[model samples]
Target chain A: MTDMSTRWKRTLCVALTGISIVTVAAASASAGEISVWVWDKAFNGDTMREAGEIYTKAHPETTFNVDDTASQDDIRAKLQTQLLAGSTEGLPDIVLIQDDIAQKYLQSFPGAFEPLSDSIDMSVFAPYKVAAATLDGKSYSVPFDSGVTGLFYRSDYLEEAGFTAADLENITWDRLVEIGQAVKEKTGKQLLDLDMNDTGVIRMMMQSAGEWYFNEDGSLHITDNAALKKALETYAKFYQADLVKPVSGWAEYTGAFTNGEVAVVPVGVWITATIKANADQSGKWAVAPIPRLDMEGSVNASNQGGSSWFLLSSSDNKEEAIDFFKTVWAGDQDFYQDILIKRGAVGSLLSAREGEAYKASDEFFGGAPVWQNFSTWLGQIPSVDYGTFTAEVDAAVAAQLPTIIQGGDIDAALQAINDQAQQQMQ
Target chain B: MNPALLRRGLVYALLSLAAFISVFPFYWMIIGATNASADIIRGKTTPGGALFANAATFFATVDAPRIFMNSAIIAVVGTALTLVVSSLAGYGFEMFRSRIREKLFALLLLLLSIPFAAMMVPLFVMFSQAKLVNTFVAAILPTVASIFIIFYFRQATKAFPSELRDAAKIDGLNEWQIFLYVYMPVMRSTYAAATIIVFMANWNNYLWPLIVLQTADNKTITLILSALTSAYTPDYGMLLFGTVLATLPTLVIFFLLQRRFVEGMLGAVK
Candidate 1:
């Protein structure tokens, strides 16, 4: 009985070993499919699938496996965990990463991603978008949508306050605060909705002046960053003037503007889709250039949120993935026009801005050439490095926003932000 | 009115209010599913005529059958293995009464305090080395001997009478037969309650499954609904519809096993 039991155990161990080998062998290779991980199925996922369809028509042997099963947070965690573990066996060929957080991943896990500029032309895309993901003199991303900032306002409310769309054009943050106070008094409505937790507006203001949380050498640029201090003071003036509506989260933030509780939404061009989703407010809305900071180097244009496509260095189908990206994302202008009209995505391909879809006037924005104006502003956006610690610093800034808005000293708040962010970065 | 009657009335009113507060979100979700995405975003309370449209869109977008099958297989298999292994270990620790085993059990409870996020990298490395990434087996294996479930069963086993095991032993029953014929039949309510809890947990499991299961076709209902909600302009109607469907299995499991759940609680208390 003992001899039989020993023999059984040995056979079972051998069988388990054989099974593990087969599973490992099966996992290592996917014959021809180039897998891409994207977050939004409606926007990036379906768009990439369409791009894949376009590619497959030319080369039948190659196929695309576009997986949008994970959230952006999930993708970040998965990528960070897998890359940190030094395991590339299950990593996808391509993944879509947001523009602001791209530097964090690139710097943290160096050589984990394939630098695309070696194969694709970096200059064909918007300069600001390209500059976002470029690291150590090498560009690494295929720029997707442009989050070019725009001042989307209700025309009826502005007119009720005796102001025209021209009054909103190329205004400064201080001037906008004045306009907001006046509009609130005249129309009895809030001028803008602000989420205290979100530091997008502050970042936009800082970027307009070509400043970031980090200096050129990636040191902490807080406490003495003139542009950021000015931006915070400008942000405080909104609350001091009593012209902003305090809201929380994406749903409430967008709801405040869409339901007409607020007059203006100075946000990314991607909000065009959300704004346009309310078809009843179509002709009532119009777009203008986002306000700049009252600083020496500030411009009227700044960016909010955008993302880029990255190829993994560990990808087995690296060559095909790059070719697929070049053919559809980088090379195709008509593809940009299609996605723009269909999904309201503003692509960053500079040449695509001259496409007919961009030039066509929209009746929604009161028949204004909104796309044309957005493209023009896209070029004027100052390039900032968006260093690795933007997320950490943004949290620090968010922590101090409530204090600053309540008439606190900007210098004291800046010191608090610097201390907290410095601790977090460690 | 009598003061006793007044107190009873107040208690009833408070209970009703508490119940309403608990159930309002579920009601709102149903109403939102029947409304357009815009109306839902506008915070409309009234139901509209979009249920069929939302259902159609959800079905078209998600492969409901395959995804449901994947969820069912993982949840069912995971719950079964968890109940068996955890119950055996719980029984062994309680019945055997050794210092070393007790210390090992204490060590496991201590290990449970470490967050899953901190252990995810090492766990992934283990799975990747074994080439179990992107498989249901990988998702289920690590979860089969859940420390939380084992702790639960260990506590519950204290209430289990040891007299039955001795009674079965004098009747010429071996340890395995005693466990099968004596303890198993007596612990029906406990097992029923555990089945519901474990099944619900496995059904709603998200993070580890997400990290392990990579393919779209291999996704669960939770992951699918999460992806839908994160869209730039999320279709609220379809998202709520998917949520309603996703919530039904757990609701049904709870509904069926609630009687046994109460009984199991009563047994544990005794």
Candidate 2:
């Protein structure tokens, strides 16, 4: 009986081993599908799917294995590990990386990303967005969205405060605070919402003034950077005037404005869909240019929360990736218009801005030709050197935000930021 | 007697309150799964009628069978190996104690203090050279020789009766045979507790698996759920539903083993 059992066990194990090898062989023999890694299922992933459908219609043989199952943090972890491990076999041919992180990947692992400047015309994108992807004159991204900041105000709430769209057109950050206080008093709604842990407002304010945390040479310029200090002071003024609703995280931030408890959201163009999500209030909203910083060089235009596509140098399908990006992302103006109308995605492709969708009015925002407005403002965004140390510095700035708003000394705060950022950047 | 009974009542009330506090998040998860995404984020604490819709979306989007299979393989293989190697070392050190082995065991405990983040880069380099990158083998191998499990097994081995091992030896059984037959069956609850722990740790593992599992085909449930949440306009109902699904296996395992693990108290006689 024991001998029979042994024979059966051995036979079973042998069959399973054979099955495994056969399956692996079959898998390897099949035609490879393009694997895409993206964050944000509803936004980027769905948009990619729409693009894939368009491409697949032309070439029926091409298949896509788009994986939107990993969040931003997961993508970072996965990409970093694969690069550090020196194994790029399983990496997707194309991956979506946030604009803020483009420089980090470019510098940390110098040959990991393929230079797209040779294939796609970098001048076709917004000069500033393209500049963020450049290292040593080799730009590496197919710029996807324009996070051009806009003041999404409730038209009803604004009208009640005796302010028109033209009133918001060329306003400074100080004027916005005064208007916020007046709006709060008149409508019982906070003019804007703020998160104590986030530096988004400060970032928006500084960048609107064409300034950054670092100088052109990548050195810390916190103390003497007039725009940054003024941005800080204006951020504090909103809190001191009690015209802001304090919230935490994305959900709370959105909830505050979406519930109509806050009159306006001073954020990126990407928030249009999120604002439009309240269908009942569609006609009540309008887009205005971002408030300018008090400093001399500050402009009314700045970018935030944009991402771009990079081709992996080590990918087996590098030529295919380059061809795919060039044909659809860089060349197809109609495809850009389709994505914009359907997904509210504002592409950086300059030629795409000449498409019919760019001229169309959005009924959701009171029939304003919002895209035309965005394109005009996109040019005014100040060209700043986004140093690789931005994340480290951003964390330092976020830590001091609560204290900075509570009437804390600006110089002491700057010293704290310098001390902490220097330690972490090491 | 009356005062003592009143005190016992007070203890039960507090215990009930603590249990309620611990279980509220799980309750919220289930409630969220039943509601629309918009309503849930609006802080709607009550359940709604969206459970079926959420379930449909989850099933449509995900490869449920494949993900659960991947999770099962890692947990099973990881659990079985961890128990065998760790228990042997534990028994060996306790039964056949030498000064060198004791010092080595002490050193292993100190090594545990070094954070996982510091070791990740070096470990990735080693795995890449061995051609184990992006494989289940890479994920399982690093955790198989877990010091925490070794420490646990050693602590449990103290309660292992010396008399049983001695009798087996007297009966002409070898050390291997004694360990296999006497120690294993006697320390069943210890194994049970370890299985629950290792399974939970392997199941909910995020950062390491995110780094190691390169292909979407090999990615696990946690990775999938995380990706879903990162979407610009995440469907919270679907996400909460997916999380509820991911959490069940560990919850079920703990529910079953926890009774045996707790009731079979360690050092009760000692």
Q: TM-scores for all candidates?
A: 0.95, 0.93
- Candidate 2, residue A108: the lDDT equals 94
lDDT of 1 by residue, B1-270 (tens): 899999999999999999999999999999989998878877899989999999999999899999998999999999999999988877777888776987899899999999988888888877766667877877898889988878877777788888877788899999788777777677778888888889988999988888878777778998888888888888889999988998899899888989988888676533
i-RMSD values for every candidate model: 4.1, 6.5
- DockQ category of candidate 2: acceptable
Candidate of highest DockQ: 1
Model 2 segments beyond 4 Å from truth? A1-33, A56-63, B1-17, B264-270
**Which pairs clash (backbone N, Cα, C closer than 3 Å) in model 1?**
none
